[model samples]
Target chain A: MSERAAAGIRIERVVKIFGDVGITALNEVSLDIAPGEFVSILGPSGCGKSTLLRCVAGLDTPSKGQIVVGGVPVSAPPEHLGIVFQRDALLEWRSVIDNLLLPIEFRGGDSRAVRPHAKALLRMVGLEGFEDRYPSQLSGGMRQRVAICRALVDDPMLLLMDEPFGALDALTRDQLNIELQRLWLANRKTVLFVTHSITEAIFLADRVVVFSPRPGSIADVIHVDLPRPRKLAVRTSELFHGYAGRIRTLFEGMGLLKEDE
Target chain B: MNRQSLQGVAITTMTLIVFGLIWEAGVSYFGVKPIVLPPPSAILRELFSELPWYLGHAWFTLIVTLGGFALAVVIGVALAVLIVESKLLEKTIYTVIVGLNSVPKVAIAPLFVIWMGTGAEPKLAIAFLIAVFAIVIDTVLGLKSVPADILDLGRALRGSRSMMLWRIRFPCALPSLFAGMKVAISLALVGAIVGEFVSSQRGLGYVILSAQGTFDTARVFAAVFLLAILGMLLFAAIVRIERWALPWHASQKDYSPSA
Candidate 1:
């Protein structure tokens, strides 16, 4: 309810050194995400994209620089952040509805008041009838959908997702990619999506941020400049192919990827 | 699965009968002394003849075992939680518990009898001592088994420490807790019997000890049979409760007769 704090995220010159091991994960990585903008971070495995997102989520502290979420600097986990991992991370003991209702439960409010919202969110994710089912009974894609509903339960200003659909098979991953796009379009929540898949980044994001390997620094930022409500068919389009090619070429230049795949 | 369970019971019954027949024939053929090795029929005859007397002692044993087991669970879980929450407890209390677990529980039974008297109190004290370590160790293992991603999920939700402990760790620890409980329950029974053996006016262990003293070998066998039934019944109860409490665990899958 704080209007002035609604500005999305300002991550200024963040660096992360994993102490003890003496490995530098991120170095002076600065990026600003506008309110309601969808940005994809495409990086190789050790490029610190996950580390950067963790810093923004306040799960990890940057060795230097500042991360501001909704006009508040994050030293501890902020109340207005949603994070989804590659693993769905649903509690096996909880039913789907209860899992989705976790944020409300965590905040210690009357969670019953959020029941209707939970139902509506489940329906929006096409998981309406499965509310009573345990996570073990669900397919991987379905579990990830429930996880996304969980992340959105609090209607956070920013959703920091680290390969949310990375574990699914190719067909299921593509399906979730479209499902996620539709959800994001409706909610218009600012999102920082991380993935290694170039096509996924090109197809889903308004901008794609690339990174170099260990002691990861931002290598390039490419704006997709594509239209919204993107369909799977868009991957066949010239502009989508152009974006993917450019991203691949950038990876090649960093020597992280082979010249031809 | 239902058929498999039936088959398992049927096979067990057949095996017991076959083994009994072989034993009885061997003892009769050899003209063995009844005191040295009684026939299965003689043992069964003894068990049924003293059914009422055995039941009284069995009931006492059951009560003490359950009482001690319940205390072990409560104290063990609280200790495990403290160990998880505080580094001081983890370093000092956990290490101490690990060290205490190595001591022979039978040796401790006499000390409990001396301090608490030759009553259910001594038996329960001994039983709790026997069972607490497994429950604490297993529950702590379960509580800590959550994936890094799951812990991150808790952090991202801005979950308070209490919330994380209750909603996340406790439920996650249930399967391991039950496994520990299975081990603990059996050990608790052993402790109660050991305490009864040391010095007790009542219970099956007392009956067995007195029967052996008087050379009533058949009665001893009968008491031993009752103890076996008691152990199986308690174990089966835990298994049933585990299925009810944790329908999501793979072990609870209806496909196994062990279910």
Candidate 2:
């Protein structure tokens, strides 16, 4: 991040090793995200992008080095953390409103006290009337919207998403990206989004971090200087294509991009 | 084949009617003795005449079956949760339960009678013994059915063990739990009857036994019909509860008339 501590997350030479023989996933990867920054981690499959995000969320630990969030080392699940996975992790049994209240319930707080706030979040995400609906009743995109709201309802300073829109179709993914940008514009929560899509990373984030697979490490970092509150139109813009082209060439260098380009 | 469709109810009704008519015609045409092969009409006649007697015995069987089923649910769920939550318990309890189930329940019926006396306690014990296994096994399967991502969500959300169990595992296990209960309900009824067959002063099983001794085949047949009715109702009640409790489960999405 250009601004120190403004990204609100600092990863210092974090290394992750798996198994006894020491298969390293992330090798001494270090990054600093400024406060209220929207940073996307772009990587190929099996890259430590998700591992890096998980470290920040305290879902996974580093074998070496440290991850400090808001001046505190993340030893366990931080109380202020909100996570959204590729799959919409909504409890089908509960209504959308109830699912939104899950973190509050897990934190053992008065969930009912946050009812009005939850309803407002739903409205903001264009899901006002869908509060009473179950996850099954909602469409795929709709469910993801509910998921985003659930992540924000806890008022976490940092939002960690692992391919949150990867499961959706192209159109729905674009729609969600716009919605996410709008939400980020309004609240400015420091977001660490992990995705395989180069276009998505460039479209959504203030800064995009690219990773190399097999002992995953930061390959390249690109600063997206596009205007905020961006829409699908930004994806077709020449500057947006330039950023995507630069990231794609890095993948091509790693032999991940097919010759079809 | 849409066998679970609402129209399947019509097929069931028609099949029962056709079977009854066939039995009636076969007995009438062959002039078979009621003691050997009682006609459906003869069984119905016995049912009407011995309604009060059947009612009293049926009530005894019902209470015993219900008592056993209740204990099976509570103890089975508690045992399942214990096994699921603790690795040591999981290692030992599943084997013990399976081993206990493998023991010939018919053989144990008499032992229960000897230990618990000739009253309903013996029946209750046998019923619980027979039904609890299904509850434990099915609930375990249900609890384990939670997807890894969902479990990851819980962990990422900092969900405690109880929260995971009650909010995630328990609700997820309910459909399977009900499936187990449906099987357990029938088995519990059979267990109660088995106990009565071994030794009991009152019960439809006792009525059947006394009828067999007196060569009153129609009365025995009538007692059996009552038992079938009870089993069917209990099964239906369990299915009803499954639908009511887990309205969100995909299995309940069919909107069948039963739902």
TM-score for predicted model 2 compared with the true structure: 0.94
Off by over 4 Å in 1: A1-7, B1-3, B254-259
Q: Which model scores highest in TM-score? A: 1
Error of 2 at B234 (Å): 0.6
Q: Write the per-residue lDDT of candidate 2 for residues B1-259, one digit (tens) a residue.
A: 3657568888888999999999999999999988899999989998998689789999999999999999999999999889899999998988898788888888868888779898779999999999999999999888889877788778878899999999999887887898899999999999899989999889999999989999999999999999999998898888878778887777766432110
> Against the unseen true structure, what C-alpha lDDT does each candidate score?
0.88, 0.88
Over A32-107, each residue of candidate 2 has an lDDT whose tens digit, in order, gives: 9998989999999999888888888888889999999998898887767778999998888898999999988988
- What global local distance difference test value does model 2 have? 0.88
Which CAPRI quality tier does the interface of model 2 achieve? Answer: acceptable
DockQ score for model 1: 0.50
Error of 1 at B121 (Å): 1.1
DockQ scores of the candidates: 0.50, 0.44
